[model samples]
Structure formats: C-alpha cells, structure tokens
Target: MSYTPPSWSPPGQRPPGPGPRSRRDRGLTALAVGLTLLVVAVTGAGWYGYGPGAGDERTRAADAKESAAPESTAPPSTGAASPRPSLRTPRPVRAPSAQELAAARRPGEAAAWIAADPTDLPRRNIRVDGPWTVGGTVVQALYREVTAYRLSDGAEVWNLTLPTPVCEAPEHAAPDGRIVLALASSGSRRGARCDRFQMVDLRTGKAGWTKELLRDPARDTPAIIVHTAISGDTLAVAEGLGAAAFRVSDGSRLFTVPTENPGRCHPDRVAGGSRLLVSATCALGDDPRTRYSQLRALDPRTGAVRWRHRTPAGRRVERVISVDPVVYTSIDNERLTDDWRIVALGPRGELRRTIDPRPKGFEHCVNVGIGAGLQPCPGVVVGHGLVHVGGTDRAGAYDLATGKLLWGVRAHDGRTLTPVGFRSSRGTVVYESATPSRPGRTFVLGEGGAGKEETLMNHPAAAAEAEYSTMAGRVLQAGGRIVVMPSFVTGEDDRRQPRLVSFAPAPE
Candidate 1:
C-alpha cells in the first residue's frame, strides 16, 4: 500500500484533485458564487426574485406557468363586456301648413272631399256612391245624383241600386269589406206595410239582403228621416209597430219589442250609434192620448230593452248625450204643466242623473223670447274644452267640462253664424265658419278668448243671402287633411259642381 501511494505523485508532482482552471474561469466562478450569496441577501431583504441571473430564473418560471395554462388567442383581460344597444327615436307627426289651410278655406276645395260632399249641397236629390269619410268606401243612396264625372275623379266609387228605391239616404257599412245599406220602401209593398231594411255589398255595386221593417209612414217618411246608426255590425230601426234590430251582416231579424199601443208609438232613434229611444204614445184608440211615455235602449242586435225609463205622461221628447250606453232625454210632459225633465239613463235603462225643470241647475229655465220668428243666432258650437255659442247679436264661451260660464262679446250685426269647425292648436282656438255676413271666414281667438276676435281670410257676402238662401256647409278631417264641404251654387239648383276645400298651417 506504501509503494502504490508513491506512484501518483511521481509524474507531475501534483495530485489529480482539481481540474484545469484558467484565470478568467476562476473569476466567473468567484463572480457566480458571489452573485448567489448576493441573491440570498436580497431575498432576505424582501427584494426576492430580482437579479441578473434571477431574471432568467423568473423568465423560466413564467414560461412554465404560461405552458401550464390552456392556449388561447385572446389576450388576457379582466372580464367580457356586453355590447350596448343603439337607441332609436320616434318620428313626429307633421303639423298643417298655411297654404294647406288656405286651400281648405276655399269653398271649391271642400266639396271635393269624399265625406262632406254628399251632404253639403242644396240639390233636391243626391245619389251618393263612393268611399266617404263617414262610411268609408261604400256605395250609398245620396241625396244628390251620381254622375260619370264623380266616378272618374274617385269621388263615387260604387254603383249601388237598391232592391227597393230607398228614398232616404240609408245608413251603410263596409264591415269585412262588405257594403251594407239600410233601406225603406214607403208604399212599394202591398197594403200600408212599409219594410225598412239593409242592402249589402253596396261597395261592389251589388245588393246583399233586404229585411222588412215596420215604421210609421208619418214620422219616419223619406223627407224627415235623415240617417240611421250602426254599431258592432248591428243596425237599429224604429217602426210604427215598435222598435226592432237586424244583423247588419245578413239583414236577419234578431228580436222585436212591441209597444203597448203598437200603432201610436212613433219611434225615433238617438242621434249617433246603434241605440234607439222609443217615445210610446196612445194614439191608436178613439179618445187618443199620450200613454205613459217611456225611454228604453233597444239592443241593436236583439229587439230587447237593454234599459227602460218612464217619464210623466205627455209627449216623450228624447235628446241623447252619449250614444254608447248612457242616454239623456229632455221630456216636456204636457201632463206635468210642460215641466222639462232631463233624465239620464244607463245602457240597461237605469236612471243615472235626473234633471227636473221645476228646480233649476239640472234643469235650465226655458227662455222663449221670440223677438220675431226664431231668428238664427250663433249656434252652440261644442268641441274640445270650450263650448263656442254665438248668434249675430252676441258670442260667448263656456267650459264644456263643468258648463261654467265664461266671457261674452257681441259678434256681427244682422248675421247668423255657426262654427263649421274648431281647432285648438298652438295655444289658440281657431273657428272655421259659414256666416250670413261673411260666407267664408276663419276667426282666430286668443287662448280662452283673451284677445279680441280676429277674422282671417273673410270672403265677401254672397248674393244668394239677399234672397234668404244659404249654402249648407260642413267640415271634415280625413286623410290627415282638414276638408270643408263644397259651397252650394246660389240661385241655380241645376249647377252641380262640387269641390273639396282644405287647409293646413304654415310649415315651421
């Protein structure tokens, strides 16, 4: 063992303990050892993971963390954000223009309108066959005659021939695009029987059905009766027998309510809608007298009393306020010393508001001051929030809601005026008119009649007024335009030129 130990030291006089080492390598080694020591010190001082070689270590650790996660092209973010929707603005309705208003103010322009034309003229007989404002597009028996010119201009759209000649302009409806017209023949039937009925498919110039009706030949003759109302596809008819209803669709009889004295009760309908207010009087027997007059709402579909009301024995005078269900009748009972009773009734004929004339408020005092034969005064023009009533002598404003009296002013002298149309737009009350003094004029009043009355675009008095003849006029709103009825030609009933007048405000 002593001989083997001597052999290693004999060749270079150095043991094979340390490998070959240069000065630069020995320096790097010393530097790395020093850096390791420095990193330990820095880590102890809370400066951990921050150093020259430590950065490489951190990068490798970051690479390892990134590789451990699922791969995704999307960049790292806090969270997803939902897209906000865009806001849309609604379009505004356009106001009328001044030129349009001026056009409407013209007499010729108004007659051309579909609805007002058929009723505006003064002709003895009119044949209305068109889509009208009141009845839409349906053939009708107008008071005036129809012509080829009217059809060409789109004024008359249908050719309706009644199965029996309908003397009065029958009520018509275009329900489900089917034209239905109510008709009545006075003596066309055998005997004194008069069948009042409806003809359908009038828009297509075809007749659908004819239902027989019984009405007093005296009260509901062709000259006196003007119109009948239809509601929800049902038409109400007043007959000498009693009151009856027929389905407007098929003209089929639904029901009938016979009066106590079927012959004496002359039935009249309320102004609008499909309800009837019957005034039953006992005129059939020898010592004829008015039996107890009762007002009842007859179903337009079935001849049943939805509601019934009893007034004092006399003449039953009925005036309807709202036609849907509630009915108001002003009965002047001759038995009660001509006491005027304003009775309100529900659709079921229940009493709602009873206004007695003997006691004021609900009843108004009847002021019958006949300076002469009832002179035309400014009529009670009611619409919007204000009630505009005027006569040639005076004009006044009343609140329509509360019936509160408002301001008053004297109007035109020797002139009878009626409000053709009223519009409360742009903080003002505009009154469209047909007056004796001025045949055509528009009165613009300040808000609530604050300012004096100002007349705009007044036309000179027509020559026809000298003969006490006046033009019948009406205003209608349709197709987004204000249309006036055509002015009637004076002194010449043969002149059949009708035109539609229209109006719109000036553009802003």
Candidate 2:
C-alpha cells in the first residue's frame, strides 16, 4: 500500500496539498539543496584560509622559540663588536694656558727634563709614559728614568733611574698603567744585545722585575732584537732566530717560537696589536738571485702558531706593520726591484689585497724612506681607513679596505708633501714640506682631499733652516696639543740636550 508523504512548506506559509507530486522527487530536491549548502560553506572557508593574517599566529610562535634560546659563546670579530676597553690611562686633556705657553717657549726652560749624561740622552724617539695621577702629581717617562713633574712649573716630584741603558724606546706602558717594559743593554751599538728586560712601576717609579734572557756567548755578531711589544699583560720580544713571550706582571716566560731553519729563514721584524702578534722571516743564502720570505701569526696569549703565509720564491717580506685584525706588509724581490707591493692580510692570515703606492709614470720610485735617515723616496702612512703615500712631487690616498685610489693631489707652490702624522680622528692628515727652506707652511690636508689647506706652523725659514726641528720625532702630539722639542735636544745642533717646547696653532 503506497502511503502519502508529508508535504514540505516554506517558513510562515501553508503546505501544498499532496496530489500528483511523488515522494522520490521531493527527496532528491532536498538532497541537492543540502549538497549546495555544504559547497558554499567550504568555499567560504577556502577564502579565509588564504587571507593575510592566516600564518601570523604560526610566525609568532616561531619567534618566541628563537627568543628563548641560549646566547653564543664565541668571541666577536673586530667588525662585529667594539674593541675591548683599553686599560691605559686616558690622554691628558688639559690644554696649555696662555701663561704656560709663554713659559714653554723660553730658550732654556722646558716642561720637564731627564738631566742625565749627554751620552745617555735618548738620541732616538723619547718614550713618553704617563701623565699618570700619582699623589696628585702627573708623572711621565724621562728617557733613562721615570720622573714626576708639575705641569704648571716643570718641577720634579720624584725620579727613578732605569736598571740599564735603554736599547730602544721603552715598550709602551701597559694599558692599565700598572707597569712599563724597557729593553736595556750595557752599550748602544747594534752588536750590544739587550740582555736585560726591566719592568718599572708606572705610578711609583719603582723597579718591578728584571729578567735577563739567555744568549749564545760564542756568537760574535750583534744581537738583533727585531721587535718588542706589550699588550694585555703579555710582553713579546722577537729577535733574529726566534720570538718569545713573557708575562708582563712577574717577568715569567710564557713560550718561544723559533724558526725552522735559521740559515734559510731569518726572522727580521715583528709587530703586535691589541690581539695578534706577527713576525716576518727573510731567506738568506748563497743564492742572492732568489729569496723567500714568510709571515706567521701567533696566539698572543699562547705562542701557538695560528697561521703562516709565505711569499713566492725570489720575493721577500721586507716589513710588517700590524694594526690589529689587519696587517700591512711590504714585499720586494732580492735585487731590490723597482716595483714594490704592499699586501693587506686579515686576522686569519688570509690575503685581502695588494696595493702599489708608486707615483704615476715613475719607474724607480722604490726609495721609500722612514725613521731618522730621511733618505730619498716617499713615505707611507696607514691609518684612518686610508693609505697615504707621500712622494717628492705628488701624494695620494687610497681606500684602506679595498686599496682603490681615492684622490691624487699635486704639491702646491712647488713644495713636496711628506706625511708627518694623521689626526687621531683620521679625518685629517698632517704633512710637512720637503723643501727645508719653506717655513711657515706645514700643510694639513683633509682625508677626501677636499678641505682647505691648514698650516701647522707658519714660520718663514725653510724646514731645514728653521730654528726648531720639525721632523717626525721632534714634532709630538698628546690629546690634540702639539709639542716641538728644541733643536739642541733633537740633535739638530752639534750637542744633543733635553728640552721640550709646546706650540699652539697659529691664528687663521
């Protein structure tokens, strides 16, 4: 028996009376409506799934996990972090007053003096130790001794003599101003070995410790002390055959690194920075036609070899200059070839790049000069993110990082420019005229070669004829203040003496 199905109705409307409509047809219509509703709901969900905020919650969860992780333990690179704070005393900030200037300029008077035998006066650069505050007095090194003097009157507060004559300038005082290391010998000639290494108290001028390194008594040649450096409580001394490290506090030996073959590889020079120690070894044998040079970096704390770089046979590393994570070295062939190259190396002894500093169109520009002799050829100064090469007729600056030439400038008024020093900020370079007769024209050129030429001294005599010595060793700066040693004290005169003169910048 077929039973009549209940009829469906719209909301608020009466149901249609059952007639010819079949129940199967009504059931199929209801099923289709239900499926359409399901499809609409899914489409709505799909649109919301791809919206902008859909993945935000998941991203935040990942970020939270990263934030809760542990910190890294490795030391930061020089580019990644600021340098460790220096322990050395901050430079003295007191600018000389008008009255102090007048007193300093007197012919016979000076800010201070060592008053030792004339033979004992530091013929080389005098090592200035401290304006350290000790018992309310500022104390500094005075060549053969440590002396405390009044800045106002140049009067002596206390004085202490070194154990032996200084072979070279004393190693720079320790960063913390606790101790100072000096290499001492019985005589001054190159053959005179610096057998005694002495540490002096920076504050009290008291002797801390003295250690005499063992030496080969049978050796006849002069003892070659290649380099001496002080950094972070360690003292490193490099010589002809080997390099050694010692604790600066008690003079205890740390470690020594010797050359593999003294006949082939002779260690010539060494340099140190805040973190790394570098040494250069040159090859010397019967074959003068070709030579080899090697450079090695050692752990400053332990004398472990970190890395070694060797030049191609027939070339040698002439000099090494370390400026922390970066090292600048000069390379040349055995015959002293005309073309010389300067190589820059990274902290790991990786080669960064090489630079040629010779002037344009000059074939024999290899006479670069440094130190007291003042030979021909230009000088090279590296600092302030720039490499400055000074030639007799021209000078130029190169980008320190990339070795790209930045600017080249011709000498003004037919005077050759020589770099004396760079300003602490590295934005300005100080140049002295090569013409000794051109006085009153110390040029201060800006880094980018765009600033006005600023004169350091405005005298009328030629540089050589000037009453005072204007050489690099004579012209000194401490915290922006300039000091000029007397010509007599600088040995410009026949008799070398001790005197200090401070100068203020001439008016514009």
Best by lDDT: 2
Q: Tens-digit lDDT track for model 1 on 1-508?
A: 0111111122222232223453433444465345434422432111111012211222233223323434444342222111111112112112223233334433322222122233243322222222244334322244223221132123445444344434332233434444344343432322222344555554355556665454334544321222344555665554322345566678766766575444554453423243444444334232213444555566555656666566545434444444444434343322221334434454466665553323111111111111101111113334455544433323444444444445544332223233434545312233344322233344555343435556543432221121111122333333333334322221123333233333333232
Off by over 4 Å in 1: 1-140, 143-165, 170-207, 211-227, 260-279, 282-292, 318-321, 325-410, 413-432, 435-437, 442-447, 450-470, 473-508
Residue-wise C-alpha lDDT for candidate 2, range 394-487, written one tens digit per residue: 4566676887776555543333345546765544444443222233234566644534455555422211222222222233334333333321
Regions more than 4 Å wrong, model 2: 1-143, 146-159, 178-184, 187-191, 216-226, 260-266, 360-380, 391-395, 408-426, 431-444, 447-451, 454-467, 474-476, 483-494, 497-501, 505-508
TM-score for each candidate, following the candidate numbering: 0.50, 0.59
Candidate 1, RMSD to the unseen true structure: 44.0
Model 1's alpha-carbon lDDT is 0.36
lDDT of 1 at 167: 35
The clash count for each model shown is 41, 9
Alpha-carbon local distance difference test for all models: 0.36, 0.44
What is the overall TM-score of model 1 with all chains considered together?
0.50
Screening candidate 2 with a backbone cut-off below 3 angstroms (N, C-alpha, C), the clashing residue pairs are 87-175, 88-175, 191-222, 436-462, 436-463, 437-462, 438-462, 440-458, 440-459
Instruction: State in Å the error of residue 488, model 1.
Output: 10
